[model samples]
Target: MMMMNKPNWRLLATAAVVSAALTACGGDDGNDGNSGEDGRPGGEPATSVSTLNLKVTDASFSNGLPVFTLLATNEDDEAVVGLQGLKVNVAQLLPAGHQVVGDPTKWQFAGDDSRNGAAEIVDQKNGYYTVTFTSLDKAQLDPNFTRRLNIVSPAGTLIDGTTEVPNGQASFDYNAAGAAADYTRNIVATDSCAACHGEGNGIHHGSYVEPETCATCHDGLKAEGGRTNRSFAVLVHDVHKVAAAEDADGHIQYPTELSSCNVCHETSAPAEELAITEWGNWSAVPSKENCASCHADNNHIMEQADSSRCASCHTAEGTGVVKGTIDAHLGEWNDAAEVISQWGSDVEMAYFADTDTTTVTVSITDANGQKLAADQVLPQIKRIEVLTNLGPNYPVLSYGAGSHLDAVSNGELANNTTIVDGSFVLPITGLPYGAEGTDADTAFSFVGLAACSKGNAIVACADVADPDNTDNYTGMKANMAFVTKSGFTPSKRHTDSLEFSKCEGCHNDNWQIHKGYHSGFVMTEQVAHDEEGKVIGLDGCVTCHTPDGTYAFNNNGAWEQKLHVVHGDKNIINDCTQCHTSFNLNAFAKKGPINTGAGANPYADGLYGTPITATCASCHSYPSAIDHMTGGTFGNGVYDVDKADAQLAVSAENCFVCHAPDVADHSNVKF
Candidate 1:
């Protein structure tokens, strides 16, 4: 292929040795780079290197030709030697005004013809690889122009212990004239996209790892044979639109507002304007076809070729025809002004216990500090749900106090009286011992109530009062307190590793999606006692997700496997620590129930016959995972004798048996 750089052998060798030595001595305690306690060079040779750190040692131009050298090392900072193949690709960074000409393929390795249909791996010594560009035109060189080197080492090439290194890459930039200020191409953070696509590598065909690298090749250019535009912004927007077109297996893969350019284009720069103008120029018209990708309604489509007509409706101030483009682009619920304009509600309550029933006296008021009239409040009251928190492994009980009730839906709490003087009484029957009589530990009560306009239903509600009054009157309100049972010791009972705020981050006000409730209420330690008197709620989830609680959907009674499958199927598996506390992650080695039944296989076949338990180590420390593999081994039909025997030998003390110096398959551990 056409070359632009040559290699510096001396510097590459020195870098390789230095990197290896430094990695041998442990540095970071975090999981990102450090493999585990076993990753230390002297502790135990890594079974396989899970990570590769690549760096450009030197770059210079010799006789109008560019050459560069690379050094590769593993997670332990050991040299990665004996790589079978290495592919080096380069993308030239153009200035803002420079127009790209010729087929864009010339900028990629796939189109380079000088290598005679074969990529070269030159000057391979230690962990260093030297790349030299034999043909580079001085006319193509610019002091301000930048170039990126993308190096890929194939899987199974760099062998360590019994593990074969998986495919690894290292990318870096160097200016042609060696000027420090020549490179400036950061547009988007890869981690932001990784919130969905996962960390590093991501889901974009593996090669397009980061946004910076993507921008290099996806310079608004169409592939040689493909009809679709390969521009980064347009391609991403269009692909997301395609994903939004249909629900995949009852889950929405892309957000509903995929076409709203501002959602993804909210950068401080003029990127949105430039992208839209380029999009129009490419299509030769701002037609409905392009506009309809995001806007399902064609009301904003331009009917004429006059470009000025676009400004009429798409301006900051809305036209007579419709709302302004910026205002209309903001989704229906996110507008602050619209939410604040609605009325709001708050609750006050007192609890008392009688021989047979527990009485809750409640009062409702509007945002204007006026008690709501009987007629104004009764029709809007959806239901008052009373929740009692029991101890660990016990189900929090819930009672629905309403006129309209489902006979099989948990216990019932009858509304004893209507709104009189803006107040009412709700009598709850069959409350648990802690809530009714006396118990050693005091129970907690969470009372959730929601009311909506005649035709509107509240889907999600906040636990605390809205500070800005924007969320009031939207649908729901709730109050929670600890119940002081008679003759009780007043000890705390319920607990959780995760908080409601984390769930609210993505779900917004609609966080209540589980347990057939759409009221946006957090269940907390409370659960609905079914007709069978079975407790169910946040605490109840653990009972079913544990080894002893092997329900049909328990996925072989392993909570990790079941959760991974469910979330993975929904395409939401990103970071594991989001929902898990640090302590929970540390103590994650407990083995759950095992099953060999036909339907007991929770993971897909792709996860079989590997060190799947090691996947837990990604979040949990490696030492913790050793116990899980060494504990009593269970079998489903998926594991063969060889795999089972291999796994059974693992122990907490001797972790290196599975995580040895040459084992590269550790991190590939599936479910």
Candidate 2:
């Protein structure tokens, strides 16, 4: 949600603390005198206060008398004293999925937020303050019920954390019984959502980024639109299933397939970062709130959404056909691991300039480093493929095309692939773009994979008993590819752009794409390598997805612009640091006009828009924004993108007047 107007207390923070300076020679002073040398105009001193940070030292509802002690600090980590108008909201956290009747035991509001707040304040003059709040009876306090204290700081640079500003709100969980409970509610971590939500402009109320923090009010007793619309699963499912804004609300579709649970949940494998303590709760703990989040209109599911009877039908002991939650989510993760021994592969490549051929060798071995038995494993090999393209910065290579070597798709040649010493050696002849002799270009060969589904017995991929389990996986993580050149020097262009590992922090394990394609999500290709030959994350993707390889099917923008558009549509790219390791290097600023598309090259209109304009168009595609980008007043003198020669239709965008050649600085780049 966007930030609303500032509170009365926030206005006081900005109020000038007047102090007279009589030693100034400037405009006429308020003494009704002429503009003379002695006309002293008061110079105001700049306030040193930045944003505020509060840490809860101790909190408890001991014996029904709620008291909270906290320490406040400014952005410089200096103690901030004499702070006032700091309010708090309290709530009770019930057990996960615990519901009475048709309503969830959500945390309703109490204290200053809901009632006439009467908090007895005590300042220790050392940034520490003790506030005794309205007392709650022992009947209101349950030892297992986790109480939440949300500190709302109104005396800071920004009370509502808008844009890049830090919102002065702090929350901490504590048991009213004055001790840590055995059953603490820890679902999604802050880092999990912070990568996409908090790191940008902060989600919802700006500061309440964590699910646990948001659950203080959003999930339970009272919500904006009741339980149906307020749960995390519901809001997340809806927003991801259909785009929220920057496009037609609910009309826009998700960038990738929504069926892939691995996009958000880390059930397939162990989470390396952003751990979810109750990762298994999604399937194990069935609730009406969970079921109805996605199956909104399903009356059968909606009826069961708010009750404790959800598991009665979905669990193993239930009479229903549906298996338990653990099986529903982790079933595939379990299926594949049973049969596949997580084998590894080694590859070698060499381009013989004399014969105009590129030979690639692939050796697959089990976890024990033993070669697979031909009769036992050859039948299970679903596909063996390799892809190649020109590198450094290929002006032609795109995701749509690849110089491929697939034994299954492309008919096997009699002398093409031969098993030599337990390794399959295949030589591909002919120069697609590379010139023969000393003028040869580099060949970047990347391996592709199509894993077979788990089976009781080793069998052909086509004859698998469970085809449903195969769709659970994606990517070409078989083995790293080899790069060879016939005197062709490689370019560092591939490794110079956005780091892929940064994206993996959110996308987890491997970023999946292309849906059910055999090589759905190819792992990082060795198209670009460091001096030590160590492969960075998905460096090969740049060889494709280039300026010319515009994935924008709507002719909206180039690949550079699309990345922003895709992430922006999700309302998460407000801050470049969300994905970029360094925005100060002008990484977000690409040169030249975007090749939106070309004539009959996937798109019919061959559109070309200005670079900076395309980046801005992602959020501001209105008529006024169009006028700003095209330098047209009321649509006059506008560059016609739909001209007879659309490729030559260049825009008269004046963004460069400020953007210039160097955008290495992060100063207000949003414009």
Candidate 3:
């Protein structure tokens, strides 16, 4: 996972020579140079840089000033000649108690036009350069200070004639006592930020590549605009606040709550304790404004109030109770139900294919393992439903006719009884038979809403309007049973890659994005049996997204690409590994180079019509893809001039004909 610094020059050069020798010879048809129908000459060798390596050869202190020498070379083991306008930045890492006071300066070299300032760069011929720090202030130096170096080339460098090499960085630690200083503790991983910021670059105008480097400049000081920028802790928190800023449509641009703390602050420590410590240090003292960020409804605290009021509910000793801020923010449903007598239900379903009918039987019981009487159950239960999964094509079928069904009015029951001795049997009509072959079996699940009734009415139920309440009486009974077909066995579809807990990590208890059912009750039959039969839970979604399922809309329903397109619409698709694991991305590549029409078209929207190799380079390095494409035949031979549009279209078999092995390494197809 480290950056690309070392490249094998010998191998690259040898491969280039071999490829040129092979191309110099004629083809099987004895055609040396011929123009195709598209007005492009065939067998034109691809010109690319074999290697571009930037390295720090040596570093030392000269008369209390730090000096370093850098070297740049190409694949032929020769100096990179005539490189100009190279910019280099040097920053000293400060200790925990210290802070930066002013903007640091960068050293630039333009050959003979270079100017000597606080830092000077001198060309030493043959790709070597000596840089020296001129003005050294002992007050800015410490026994434990470390230096970080970053070098970047101007707009274009002659690597493969026109390709530009990416920047590189190196770190140097200096100790006055001639010993190594203990490395500072990192609060957050760069990969987490790269998940949305595209490899840690292209964020904040590419000025900073890593968080440590960012801390050097944005260290709680006023910038050129006369506005003070807070420390990293405060800046990051305030920037991502749910109501911090709004877009033209009056919607919050970065709508994330503090409840999703684990998504970023995912240390080994308990998230609850980590959040308290992080926020406590950031604010120093709690304020009503801080509390109002997430708890806008709780208006008990005054603006001038200190941490004492917050500690009353957020600390164990202050309130004479064990509850704290964690318990208060997580909501009541996080813990077990308090009532001693709890209610539950068990359901069984039998289907009759000839009559297109399904018979459902339900039994009710209490926490003490005793069946309640029919009259007692009828008054406590709110509703009961039977949901059926009818294979891949058809949607799930729900048997609940209306909002609330009365025992006496709804007469689809056996013997016209809704509940008899805590049990009831109802026959529902118009259920379709299961599909043939692998999908011949059907799954039926039951849902019952049991409430703590007040005055013969179910009150304090769990609804979308008020989701934090624990008084909601909801229970699910999922049972897999074959329809009235002989020798039929039901099985689940492919294993899901995305976990429900992962979604809950950001969406919290309420699946707020969809703005309907909460994640807490997504698996229940009530939410799973929607009007469109859109399976509510992540587990149920795979049934409808199976190989045989209908997916004419949205990238032909290729789950991975469709997910990318959806997130791209929301401007969240930056790094591929954000949603997919490294193993998953490798597996996708193993399915062979994409865009050959083997699977559903994965390119859409932001990536629509993008080249196959260029798209592959989004997650992979350009050099690695060059090796894969040149190792063997790739892509279809037919290159559609209109289909390619702006992307490179070439058969893997003839990739080397256009892109020579050496120049391929420095191609501009990658991000």
Candidate 4:
């Protein structure tokens, strides 16, 4: 099963110290060592200045103090000595508006960041210096300040510098102030939003590139009498209006009336952008009117009842089968009825060109619940199609099946719930279903043969021939010829090998509704109709509700108590300073030798909790089958009744034999 391709052979063998080869050493900003090619520390002196790279350890805070780590290194070509006299200064910039809200004097600093005006040198001999500060009060620095640092010689001659670390832009909140203005007639430029958001992969989804990406579809010269012809605003507003359903407030608003600016505008790349928190439920998602300013007549505004209207934005021509979505059952031809005409309702027919030694049994029954003769059957089904979305006509038919297949039993066709066991056994041979021709060895290609047959005989025989034209069988399904190939291979065995049990772990139906809410999705049954077609029946929180659940019991007990009892009492002993922020503590924070906040669990330090796996063995590992002990030697709970007391007799310290506690702090204390 582990087929190692030639290109990956090196990855299986080489264990290098570094995963990537070293590239040219970019200019040292005094933060990098200036080692010469010979590897010795010898180098010509450019200057005695040293560079220090400083990084903030804290991520985000509304108004709390920030944490930082300072790393100092000699940037000069020569390794200088006597680093003990060096001085580092930290400062911040106050935006003009912020100056009016807070004291400007609080943003200034005097000496090194340390309270004592001294820095701890980890590798001082190597020009390494570090300092930590929990408050700007000590250095007279601003809490909201964003700026750089300057390292100077003891005499005040500046040695090195760094770029400014700008404060997070709290004023440009898309959800709050940004949407207050109505640019209904004028369009906001996507380029203006992409300035910082497009730093990495400037392209996202299909044609949405940086700058001109908005013009890919929104340049509205295609229509007349439109304001700001290419306005994405109109397109978004109309789209939301069309998608939304009636609510207590009448027509539901999208992106929230307050957060409408975030429909296409975001702080980061489109894919990674934050979703509007107040956006209504997906079922209540507004319609095209919200987006008409830009994508005016996209897909001409498809109807919701007719799910096929969604094809305009989510098909191969649209998104090319986005991950986590059921693929459209209609084959490459996109001919729905033509697809149903080929493979009939019988799910058990062994597709032809099968090289694997697996048997497939198909059965067909008429309305009277009686098996019909293959020869006498006309307009009978030969295969079943699974669809993701139902159009106005319901199940769009899938194509490509032939009349030459055996009629097995009436029992198999009794119900839709019964998955054909025969289909699971037959491993489809010759080009796996989706294999493109490029991968010859791995791809399954169709052979040119009439494959579907009664029993073992292909229906291409003389008796089943058309009465009018004996030369050709009109019963032949379209495109069936293209699939009959000799040398095609399968990517995955075509047998019913996709297991639902594996899905149960993440999509448990009983308790957690991760698979039902907007976080996930689930489809119920495949409903077949007359003229409307077949459609997958759907019902779930994600379809109609918001992040919250439907039932009141879930909202009260399980949501609050049971969930808290299960995941609460959390303990994360990783960082001591998170809870005790009167002192700074973070991954990048400079640390002191004192154990003042040592081993203090941050999660347990707070009131919230995190979820832990409820594996059977987590609480049960004892040799005995029955014991109430929380933890003991060899195990925690008894697995055997006879040995219950025996395992408990062993000292509690013995529990570490197999069940180990986190080394930092194991005491079961609240504080």
lDDT of 4: 0.25
Off-target runs (Cα >4 Å) in candidate 3 are 1-132, 135-185, 194-209, 223-231, 243-257, 270-389, 393-429, 438-516, 519-539, 542-566, 575-577, 580-671
* Candidate achieving the largest TM-score: 2
Worst 10 residues of 4 by lDDT: 167-176
Report lDDT (Cα) of residue 517, candidate 3. 25
**Sorted on TM-score, highest at the top, how do the candidates line up?**
2, 1, 3, 4
Candidate with top lDDT is 2
The clash numbers for all candidates, in the given order, read: 24, 7, 8, 75
- TM-scores for every predicted model: 0.51, 0.69, 0.46, 0.20
Give the Cα lDDT of each candidate: 0.40, 0.49, 0.38, 0.25
Q: Give the clashing pairs for model 2.
A: 106-220, 106-221, 283-325, 288-305, 475-521, 476-521, 476-522
Name the candidate, 2 or 3, with the larger lDDT value. 2
Tell how far residue 474 is off in model 1, in angstroms.
4.5
Residue 302 in candidate 3, Cα distance off native in Å: 11
lDDT of 2: 0.49
In Å, residue 218's CA in model 4 sits off its true spot by: 11
> What does candidate 4 score on TM?
0.20
